[model samples]
Target: MSSLDAEPHAPGADAPRSPGPLLAIESSCDETAAAVIAADRSVLSSVVSSQAALHERFGGVVPEIASRAHVERILPVIREALAEANVTPTDLSAIAVVTHPGLVGSLLVGVTAAKTLAAVWDLPLIAVDHLRAHLYACRIAYGEEAFPACGLVVSGGHTNWYDCPDAVRATLIGSTIDDAAGEAFDKVARLLGLPYPGGPSVQQAAEHGDPTAVPLPRPMMNRPELAVSFSGLKTAVRYAALGNPNSPEVPAPPLGERRIADLAASFQAAAVDVLVGKCDLALKQTGRPTLLVGGGVAANRALRVGLTDLCERRGVRLCIAPMELCVDNAAMAGLAWESFERGEFAPLDCDVTPGLVRA
Candidate 1:
């Protein structure tokens, strides 16, 4: 049977036209994810294959390793999603893929896979912006009421603010001038001898440490612009952890558990302070009554608490993507349905964009 005939209908009445299931693929970074989502925002199945272990020894994501991993996992992940959703390729109304602002090699794997599938299945192709997909996680979690708000996308590779008037349109309002929030966390975690994917590790350590135990600078706090900077804050953590680089001939003292916890707490607090401050400023400047925050960093307990408190005080509605959706995943890419509804399908010649700022 065709997908249109399978759509749900109101009781005792004819069913109105609605979008069919869409298959979305996301490989913008290290995660290879796929999902099948219906027009009513119901996610039938979502699958993600992570490469965290493969890059753990390197203390960060190695681009080559990540891309290779994606190439190996993308097909299986997509197949699993389709199987779990109980749908075949021909059942899908369109195929969506994130095509921008990520490791180029990684992006290419997903894009090429999606393009080949679209050609074979004769499906409409929709191109999604990786960062916008992060924000769309909020919309997925909260429904249509989440828009007309200020969006903050904080992740390992991106820290950007947007004025999101709707699901498909976002105006860039502010961004990081240096390292992203999650990137800084990873760097500091490495300095403290913590594991890869620093946000959770740092949060866990900070739970036992006093946030005020040590002082860390809040970069760009006084700047009039809404931009945030974490490079200086990251350096401060490095100095506190390792002392001066020039005078480090002597073996440095081992970081006690308490010292590590304290440093993590202090650094997390400073980063949260700057992020909250900038979010507050964005809301005021844009006059947006709602605030939507997503991306991997949105999973941080500290950031969640900070944003919740800020939104409460300012009377702004706050919608944070659930932890599962906050991290890179294709479920969020279900946002492609919005473009599909607007007839914004991409041509077969579309290419990947690797930079954050798009024209």
Candidate 2:
């Protein structure tokens, strides 16, 4: 039986419209993710296959390997999502995919899969911005929260501020002049001989390291503009480890447990201070009462705490996605509902834009 006739429908009332069932795919980076979502922002099924093991030895994600993993896992992930959701292709109204601002090879996998689904099933194609997908995680997290708030997206590859008018429309308000917050975290983690994927390792070590043990400069804190500079902070961390600028590389001196913890506290404090400061400035300029933060860095416990405290003091409500959705995942790709409803579809001529900019 056809899907329409499978479910009972009221006469003359178009077939019962369940929330738009959207299938979303995200391969903008090392993670291969797919999800089935309903129009009301209900996540039916979410699946993510990470490529950390493949690239761990390489320090970071290798585009070619990431693409291969996506190609192999794409079908299985989608199949699993559909099975978990108990939904079929015929039941889906559209397919959404992240098409740009990532490894070209990685982005192509999702885009190709989405286009194939759109063509074979006559489904509408929804092209989602990778960064915007990060912000949409906030929407998924806080269903009833007011939108059009400011967003601070921090990730391994990105650090930027935006005026999010809505899920689909975002304006770039500020961005990094050099390294991203996550990149800096990773670099500092390496400098400290922490493990790969530096954010967490650094957080863990910083918990025991003395952030105040070494005085590090906070970049661009006094700058009048929204632009940020983490390159300097990264250098400071390097100097802290190696001592003098021209000196040979040396191991970081042992600090007492409390001292190590203080260093961690201090490093986190410096990063959090700059982030909070910029976000506060953005909120004041936009006059938006709500602030939303997303991206991998949003998972940082310190950042979350610092932002929350800052927002509380300023009377600005802050909304952040749970840790699960904060990192790269297709569940947040559910924002396709907005694009589908608005009849926004990209042309076949669309190509992968590796360096796509939101600002």
Poorest 10 consecutive residues by lDDT, candidate 1? 2-11
Q: What is the C-alpha RMSD of each candidate to the true structure, in Å?
A: 4.6, 3.9
lDDT of 1 at 59: 88
lDDT of candidates 1 onward, in order: 0.89, 0.81
- Estimate the lDDT of model 2: 0.81
Clashes of each: 0, 13
lDDT score for residue 185 of model 1: 94
Residue 176 local lDDT, model 2:
92
The most accurate candidate by TM-score is: 1
lDDT of 1 by residue, 1-359 (tens): 43322433223534555557999999998999999999987889999999999988998999999999998999889888988999876568889999998999999999999898887777789999988888888888898999888999999998999998888889998999889999999999999988988999999999999999878899998788989999999988887787858777754456899999999999999999999999999999999999999899999999999999999999999999999998999999988988988999999889999887552
TM-score of 2: 0.91
Total backbone clashes of candidate 1, pairs 3 or more residues apart or in separate chains? 0
